[model samples]
Target: MALKPFLLTMLDQATELCHRLAAHGLVVASDGNASIRTGSGFYITRTRSEFENLTVDDWRWMPVVGAPTTGVSSEWRMHQVIFHQLPQVGAIVHCHPPYATSFAVRGEALDGTLLTETADFGKIAVAAFAAPGSGALAKAVIDDLGATGSACLLQQHGALTIGQTFQEAVQRMERLERLAMVQWLVTAGFPAHQTHE
Candidate 1:
């Protein structure tokens, strides 16, 4: 089926956001995935897609309720679960940002109180580890994200963020990584660098 202009625009924006994510080091190679809920289903990155060169056409549309298909990101199920359980979430981003993933590897959740940007999220929950892309992972993620939380970290894995728009989701991920970086620096006794701004 032909996608409407609005959907096409959303695809373009999503593609651009992926590039931004890559340029900022939030995602590398084919390491992360994103999706936007459209109508009854959603458009997601294809399996093994490199964000730096991702194109709008590279996204695949899958029904909200359907059998899993091949050639899509292994974590598609996680996106699907959020859409199904959190009716307000219109976009989802899953990535392994270095600092945030470090927290995940260390089995630590972000102290959302440290940064104004993160304060609203409170303490970001860290979901228990489950095999990547498996149903168990999906369930674990949704349980952590719950009905109101906007972000969650996957234990020993990565992080996930949801939003009413792709931009919102991407911003949350970026803020999350920044929060993690600040906490890491604090823990290491790295003196704060004075900013001219």
Candidate 2:
């Protein structure tokens, strides 16, 4: 079926956002995935496609009312679960940034309270570890989203953020990584470099 102009726009924007995130080191290679809810179901990036550069034709539409996603990303289940559980989330981003993934590997949730801007981020939850791309991982992410609305850190995997738009979720992912970096620096006693901004 031919996608409407709006859906095509979404595919373009999602592709751009995915590339931007990858350029920023927020997601590397095919370790992360992105998706946006569609009228019938949703459209996700192709399996094993590098999100760094996606064309308009790269999105695969999966119906929410039909058979389960067949050859999509292993974390396709994660997006599926989110769309099912939360009616409000329109876009989802899953990434494995270095600093954030470090915390995830250690099963540590972000303590976003040190900075006023990130105070609300303190509620970010860490979903328990499960085999990657498995139904168990999807359930764990769903449960973590239950504890917070903005974002969740996947145990031994990566980070996931939801937003009314894909851009908002990407921003959340950036903030989550920043918070992690600051916390890491503080724990390591690294002196804060003053920026002349």
Candidate 3:
């Protein structure tokens, strides 16, 4: 069956978004995954798909209520839970950007007081560490974000952001990293900089 133009456009935009993340050095190789919520399900990047080389074939349509298929991202459970619990969210971006994930690893959290971009987000909650792709991790994420937050950090793992639009989610991720960077600088004192992953 032929795919509708809007579906095609969604795939195209997802592909472009992945490429943009790679171009900005926000994600490397197959380091992250993204999804767009559809009425019945969602579209997500396939496992092991490199962002810089992503094509439409790298995406898969996943039913919201079923067991995830073999090729879908391992973190699909996290995305699935968020969509199910947060009806207002239309898109999700999960990435291990260095700056933000640094805070995750250190058990630190970012707050809206840090930047104007983060103002509406309040505290960027940090979920307790759980093995990747586990139901426990999914529960942690939803528990944190579901309690009135738009972004979260997976302890010792990465960051996740959701939005009413894909671009909004992507921008939030960017703003998160930027906020982390500035926070580090301000806390570290002047003329002395530290780097992290």
Candidate 4:
């Protein structure tokens, strides 16, 4: 099928974000996915595809108003719920970063109390545990979308972030992972540098 202009843009963006995820070690193999809304639908990375080697053919375009799950991410429900709830969001990126996943595994919040950078990214709440690809997980993510949160750590899972653009979503994911690392370092007895006048 011929790709629409918006979908074409989304494909390019998804490919870029996927490469970024792999290059920055935020995800391994086919562990992460990126998507962008085109019209009332979205273009997302295909399942089980490596982010670093994505191609135009690796994208699947689906209508946002449908529940069909033939060839989309296993977390499609969560993505759909989030994008539907946040009209301003144009892109979504989900990845499994080491530090963030570590915190998730421990059922800890990725809060700014650990570092200034975390504060800059706002507070990262750790959503309650929900089985992967389950409706429970989707609702858990929705509940975490309260105030002062742009990203959330899925307990025992990974991380999810949204943005006004593909680049913005990718940037948030990167920031979230960095904050996770800092949180780990601080909690592991490495004191963070204190800014002073």
Candidate 5:
């Protein structure tokens, strides 16, 4: 990984974000990856990285194009493709937070009826099913996210969020799952049982 000065602070920030997300039950095991835009490329969490225990050396540098390295996170293509597609997005977060993944596996959209959440996220869309680590998966997410560029639910998978900064992306990921949790609680009559694949 390219250890540029611009990426140094992000290393610590991203590590903290991962730990926080894990503490809040937003991500588990090796289930999530994050990336930040570098001057020339981006540094993504490597495959099998334990988010809560991430090290500064855990990231892999990847360009916007060309063949992706396998040791890096399998979902790098999704981040790369989005960067190429939307210039405004500066960070990406992909995670399988329980509530959102439950909705995704059931092939449902997180209800946009909550005015407060809807006003910000617009609509949380679930992309058509595509095999993980494939370009098709990236395209599916891109298609579902549309031009406005909010968070998206990967069918039978998880959630993806893009923002102008890594902090913003992390917040969006948290918000999406929280919204889904609230919706499930209200509609499913409490008990609060989370079902996921």
Candidate 6:
């Protein structure tokens, strides 16, 4: 199917943000994917595509109403499930920021009170470990989304964030990482709780 102008714009934006995510160390070695919904369906990064070198052609268009079973992200199921469940979400970003993934790997839920940004993004939740590209992982993410949160840490995997727009989703991913970094530093040697008193 032909790509619409708006969807093309979103693909370009997603490619740009994907590169930024890689350059900023939020993703490494093709470890993440990003997507934006289109009137035709959803356009997502291809499986194993390097974010640093993503191009418009690297994106695959999946129809929201009748998606095919091929040529999509390995984690297509995750995107499909979430987009299907959350009609309000317009974009989705999945990244493995080091600090945030560390918490996921360590089985630690992000402290919602770590910083104001955390609350602004809503509380982050840690989904139980599930193999990547599996229905189990998709289910875990959906379950996390069922909560009142904007982000979810995929245990032993990475993180996912949804937003009403592509830029918002990207920003939330970046903010999640920043909050995780601050939380790590503070808990390592500084106070465990905020000094808002």
Better of 2 and 6 by lDDT: 6
Error of 1 at 183 (Å): 0.8
Model 4: residues with Cα > 4 Å off, grouped in runs: 113-118, 189-197
Q: Count residue pairs with overlapping backbones in model 1.
A: 0
TM per prediction: 0.93, 0.90, 0.93, 0.88, 0.91, 0.90
Against the correct fold, how does model 4 do in TM-score?
A: 0.88
Better of 2 and 3 by lDDT: 3
**Cα-based lDDT at residue 35, candidate 2:** 84
lDDT tens digits, residue span 1-197, model 6: 47779767777777888888888989888899988887657888888899888998889878765654567889888888878888888889998999999999998888757777667665678898889989899999999878446789999988999988988899899989999998888887585665876
Error of 6 at 100 (Å): 0.3
Q: Give the distance in Å from residue 109's predicted Cα in candidate 5 to where it truly belongs.
A: 0.7
How far residue 58's Cα lies from its native spot in candidate 5, in Å, is 0.6
The full ranking of all candidates by lDDT, starting with the best, is 1, 3, 5, 6, 2, 4
Tell me model 4's lDDT, rounded to 2 decimals.
0.80
The candidate that wins on lDDT is 1
Give Cα-based local distance difference scores for all models.
Answer: 0.90, 0.82, 0.88, 0.80, 0.87, 0.84
Better-scoring candidate (lDDT), 3 or 5: 3
- Local error of candidate 2 at residue 175 (angstroms): 0.9
Give the alpha carbon lDDT tens digit for every residue of 110-152 in model 3.
8768787689888887999999989999999998887568899
Candidate 3 local Cα displacement, residue 157, angstroms: 0.4
Cα RMSD of predicted structure 5: 4.9
Model 2 Cα RMSD, 1 decimal: 3.6
Q: How close is candidate 3 to the true structure, as a TM-score?
A: 0.93
* Error of model 4, residue 133, in angstroms: 1.0
In model 2, what lDDT does residue 46 have? 75
